[model samples]
Target: MLLVDFVLLSIIVGLLRKGSLKKIGEIPIRKLELIFLSLIIRYLPLFLKGSLKEYVVQYILVVSFISYGLLLYSLLSNWHLKPLRIVTLGVLLNFLAIIANGGKMPVSLLAVDFAGLGDFKQDLFNPLYPYHVAMMPKTRFKIFGDIFPLPKPYPNPKVFSLGDVLMGIGVFSLIQEAMLKKKSASDKISRRKLKRNL
Candidate 1:
């Protein structure tokens, strides 16, 4: 959800900067299918938990590692893009944190409470959750966990990590670059056409 907000904000900023949505299609992102596939696999357990809870939980760690690997591979394939490199760094941070924390993201209880989502504390601590674990004194990679809070007055209150913040910035920059590039190209074409007509 926070990511959605980041994208929306980026698009709005791009439009304000006289950038066109048409240029988004011009961004040369590779292995787009792998990105989608990784997300689907990462969240598959959540959807199947009703009936296949045990099965999903049993292999959740393997599935998570595989999904993260796929995502990292896809991002690495586009390393030529500066913004994507930043995004790759962000993903790497998250991957390390998850791997160190036993295949689950550690969530700060203080951040959750600060975000006014205390009700979800139990879920975060639940062994069956298969995604997040409550941050504890012994939690590894605690610095990379979801320690930041987005309090109310912001449409959606939630907790996020440093990696998430970096990813958002990278995404914003990517959109801005695409939008400006399109505008520059169009201007060049118009100037060429004008000179030919004169």
Candidate 2:
């Protein structure tokens, strides 16, 4: 949901600048396949049945977190892009926090209540949702947990983390930068074609 907010904010900013949706498509995310691989690994538990689901889900969660770290590392390894680098660092922080807390992203009960999901239970293996669990007194890396609440002030009420804030900034910067670069490149091409025609 944090990522969804990033996308929506980026789109609004892009529109404000008269940028086209195609500009966002031009963001050069590196090792994109690794991101997909991580998702596939994360969701792989859905295919399991019976008691095997719990054990396999736990194992896959570890593997999925590892895959996520790899994806961030891969993205950082390429382009030397500042925005992507920031996002990679943010993702690394989130990965570390999640792995340290048994591969589940810690959710603050207070934030949950603020989000109008106060009735949220301690269900970690809900088939409808995955990889999220309530933050308890024993949850490690408490600062990295979902402590931020976007309440009624915003249309969408959600809980987010500090790393999520960092990543949101990075996502907006990446999209805005891509839009400028795309427009600049298009202008140069148009200029070249015009000169040739003349």
Candidate 3:
């Protein structure tokens, strides 16, 4: 997805700079984005569960929220705003979701029952557990929004949602926008220099 974003963004930038796609209003709408969003929405309901489901859904949502927030800020901001704002939002959302859903993101203690991770599932369920990476922040997060390969799972593993994919795409788009801006600025500078010399 990131690679695709870069390619699409590069082409768009080239067109805009060359005056082929002359106006911001002329930009094409992203239809395929709707399909992607639908797929993500399918996973959002997992948060209501107490079992491993809730932890997985919430984890995906938080990551997506962060990534999407970053993407939106980069695209909409004047390019002068600090990037940290987007990153901070992502982190805060993740923390809040972790707190709201459970002390950790409700990992399946049962699954880790056999992993010999010293009762990882029990620790994840425990309200008193510290904010260790194994508990809240790390385990339940997405692995590119796919199945997790648990290494002695201490917390829940392999969960994500529609929000995560959206966030990933948004992050991809923002990066594309940044590269486009740089190319635009460079083109403008070259044009100005040429005009001055002429």
Candidate 4:
């Protein structure tokens, strides 16, 4: 998903500016473990036997929704940060769509074709292996689902949700601020040391 790519790119940008990886610090979530646990909950079922009936599959997705919700709440609790606030709104929008749709995210076929992901049933699943189904006539909050595309010629062509866009913005802003903050602190320390040496 673009969220993963967005986070990776944010860290890369910070490091490129000579900001130490440590400058990114811990994301200001109260229960950091919950975030990790959420990821595991969302992805652990992919390896399970596909022989699972439809309802069982849906239940697996329900567990994923709950886990992801906890993680989102942890992040939102720190919403005073501009980036976090933007990310929270985007996440809630996505959550609304997922929860309303049998716990599976809806991806528009048009978006998939636009991304050149092909019409293969297997390709229907997002590469993130998120429990997503094709968007139907009655999909709620369809705008929040994977309805946008990064088409061919893009390094990573993919269908993304509106939530993905806002999350990307938040991630970029968070890293930019952290890197600048670290630089300011370093400059202050250096000036102080220089004066003492003088």
Best candidate, TM-score-wise? 1
Once fitted onto the true fold, the runs of candidate 1 whose alpha carbons sit more than 4 angstroms away are 183-198
lDDT for each residue of candidate 3 in 111-134, tens digit (9 for 90 to 100)? 244344554545455443432223
Candidate scoring better on TM-score of 2 and 3: 2
Worst 10 residues of 2 by lDDT: 121-130
For each candidate in turn, the TM-score is: 0.90, 0.83, 0.30, 0.81
Q: In candidate 1, which residue pairs get closer than 3 Å at backbone N, Cα or C atoms, i.e. clash? A: none
Top candidate on lDDT is 1
RMSD of 3: 14.1
| Order of candidate numbers by TM-score, starting with the best | 1, 2, 4, 3
Candidate 3: what lDDT?
0.42
**In candidate 2, which residue ranges exceed 4 Å CA deviation?**
46-49, 122-130, 182-198
Clashing pairs in 2: none
Instruction: Return whichever of 1 and 2 wins on TM-score.
Output: 1
Question: How accurate locally, in lDDT, is each candidate?
Answer: 0.88, 0.75, 0.42, 0.76
Location of the lowest summed lDDT over 10 successive residues in candidate 4? 120-129
lDDT of 1 by residue, 72-177 (tens): 9999999888998888888888888888887888999999999999888999878788888899999999899999999989878999888888888888899889
The positional error of residue 87 in candidate 3, measured at the CA in angstroms, is: 9.2
The candidate 1 region of ten consecutive residues with least summed lDDT is 49-58
Q: After superposition on all CA atoms, how large is the RMSD of candidate 2?
A: 3.1
